[model samples]
Target: MTLAHEMAFASPQITAYAVEATEYPDLARRYRVTGVPKTVVNEHIEILGGLPEDAFIEQALG
Candidate 1:
């Protein structure tokens, strides 16, 4: 996950979280996570489904 790299302990700039939607029902509901592989960036940008590495990185950063 590019977010991991960006938020790495070595040079942290952000916080990233990965939640199991089924395991954490409340979180899933709060985020309206109805599917797997959901990417939420900064609690604002959201990318559903999958994208190429370059595109994923781009979205994650933007």
Candidate 2:
């Protein structure tokens, strides 16, 4: 989550959002979130679990 915020800060093209599954049940359900720390990029790239910064950026931007 910190990385996401950092990336967003570093680049204006990037936007990051942090949503609590428990707080937004409908949103979580729509995203098919099954675990914490899930990252959905462009509404398609579903990264589940914590990842190293490089790997996370690769998957997110690649």
Residue 45 displacement (Å), model 2 = 0.4
lDDT at residue 33 of model 1 (Cα atoms) = 84
Residue 7 of model 2: what lDDT? Answer: 92
> Largest TM-score belongs to which candidate?
2
Looking at model 1, residue 10 earns an lDDT score of: 37
Clashing pairs in 2: none
What ranges in model 2 sit over 4 Å off? none
In candidate 1, the residue pairs with backbone N, CA or C atoms under 3 Å apart (3 or more residues apart, or in different chains) clash, namely none
Q: Please give the CA lDDT of all the candidate structures.
A: 0.74, 0.93
Candidate number with greatest lDDT: 2
Worst 10 residues of 2 by lDDT: 43-52
Q: What's model 2's lDDT at 40?
A: 94
Task: Kindly list the per-residue Cα lDDT of model 2 for residues 22-61, writing each as its tens digit.
Answer: 9999999999998999999999988889999999999999
Per-model TM values vs. the true structure: 0.73, 0.95
Overall local distance difference test of candidate 1: 0.74
TM-score of 1: 0.73
What is the C-alpha RMSD, rounded to one decimal, of candidate 2? 0.6
